[model samples]
Target: MNEPFAGAAEKPIPEIWYGIPHGYVQVDLDPPVEQIEELVQQVLALPDGLRAQAEPVVQFYAGFVTALNKQNARACLLGMHLDEYDEPATSVITFSTVPAHGTSAKAIIAGTAADTVDGSAHPLELPAGLAYFSEEERRTPAPGRPAEGSDGPLMGDIWQGTVAVTGSGGSEIVVIQLVTSAVEMAEDFRNILLGVAHTLSFSDPSLSGDEAGTGAREPEPDSVVAAVRSVFG
Candidate 1:
């Protein structure tokens, strides 16, 4: 006998992050947008009362990463709502794969360390088990910028960590960042994020129906300045 709704079922996957234990809140690195969209449409087709139940689903889709520099490159984003997350730092991490041109991970790491050292940056190493490069710097906000009704500028810290990994036929650079006005919390935030990065992993190259690889088509670049203005203006 043929099962009618078998195709619409969702499979459950274990929620383990390397060796770190995650409870209740499950994180999905990159979710299948197509299936989410299909479910959204199905919910929309439902009559009134039942539609409200789909609101959370709609919100979840809103947080989906619609595009990035690499069309098929994998990205991990942690969406924090200002009202709910209440953290002083705004962090962003991006991973992109491109032609290696015979570049080795060791060379990339060395180059990163040298470049930062020239810029007066304090070099930092990846955790005991991870292999990546990182650096930190203090950033003082413009003196005239309005902040907390204060006449003086606000000081903060900015950290960036980068690592290169070999992929199918190219190399991938994983960049982790942390920007915060919370000077007292800066170091803690950096360590926390770096710890999360230590567990980073990737999947094997995959081919779609017509595409050669996942993220094969690049997305149009979006300007951060323009995006901020569009949202706040």
Candidate 2:
């Protein structure tokens, strides 16, 4: 199958600089407003106990939406865009809540971009996995080969990095896999991804508190296979 993103490739290493593969998950508040409002009204009309569980959900949703909007704008400024294949720009603010329950909700966004000697590539592969990671993990680095262009250790394989967020009522994560014709460029990409995560944490208010420290755990290989089957079945 094609890689999660469209422009991914496994080309040979470059002579100039290496590319960095980085990913992260960020936690931001997202709630289905209309649905929550409607639910709130219904709960208020009901007995007190029924409304209690629903109240946290409403609060969580409100916080989520506020965070999502702010983060979306921030991503755009950082050269990231919402995954149009899955969600429209307008609908980004709508109430398409997932079928799960809790005082929390989530919104995932991710993509890959390349920086060449010439120009940068568009972001790709904003998968649900990346989204979930943004909410849970802080910064998780997996073992992978280094890219080409390095003068010391690690000279011809890709390096992977990830960051995530969780807590309150929701979570978000982003992962990046950096590789390039030039090992230098790859290393640069890794640093850039790290900087981006830090910047996101600083700018986005919802990523505050213990939630921002949450790290995403990798799913088991078997579970991954099952998920893929469910999606493509």
Candidate 3:
């Protein structure tokens, strides 16, 4: 038996992708699977009329997984779509795992419409839960404010950043801290940071230039850093 089994074990799947560690969470949306299941169950429980209306919405959510797989194997998201009118539409959100290397995980979000009316394509808003940091947290630490020593501010621990991009337009905000200890935390942070960066680069009105093409502006690094720190503080 030992002879028969020797050197015959199945090789473990290597967790490497695009040169990044294979163990990190890699998706646009990172909602708890249980929460998603619960939401599905609730939708299933609705009456036919409600279910009929909700079917397309649910399909859109499910399609996110497919979209991620199709666009970026390592990207994913927790997103939803609402029909402002009774027309069919499809939206795509892209997530990219970032920070290049060293297990400091992150990702970004960008949205595009397959077919729709004007203004249909826009970056989706970050959910409240993800934006845990208050505006106060984003404020620069005052001269006398308690400095983060070895053990940083309690709020800083849950920091996150966000960038929403819609058809070359969007906004970004940073969350200071969130209390998640999974190995994937870094990846999550990266996603939010990239999302914010992409949105700012593509959308912020300050960066827009007139037909003369003379007034292109760049986002302030301090603002970007503050946004990231606010969430990860």
Candidate 1 vs 3: which has more lDDT: 1
Report each candidate's C-alpha RMSD, comma-separated, in the order given: 15.0, 22.5, 22.9
Instruction: List lDDT for all candidates, in order.
Output: 0.41, 0.31, 0.33
Q: Write the per-residue lDDT of candidate 3 for residues 1-233, one digit (tens) a residue.
A: 00100010121111111111112232434457898788889989999999888877877766766665453333332222223463322212233322323321112332122232364333434321122111111322222335557354333222233332221111222211112222224454445443333222212233223422666444244333233334333
Screening candidate 1 with a backbone cut-off below 3 angstroms (N, C-alpha, C), the clashing residue pairs are: 71-215, 72-214, 72-215
Kindly list the per-residue Cα lDDT of model 1 for residues 95-122, writing each as its tens digit: 4444445786446655665676456333
Please identify which of the two predictions, 1 or 3, would achieve the higher TM-score against the true structure: 1
Candidate 3 wrongly placed segments (more than 4 Å): 1-28, 73-93, 97-223, 226-233
lDDT winner between 2 and 3, please give it: 3
- Against the hidden true structure, what lDDT does model 1 obtain? 0.41
Top-scoring candidate (TM-score):
1
Q: Model 3, residue 230: displacement in angstroms?
A: 15
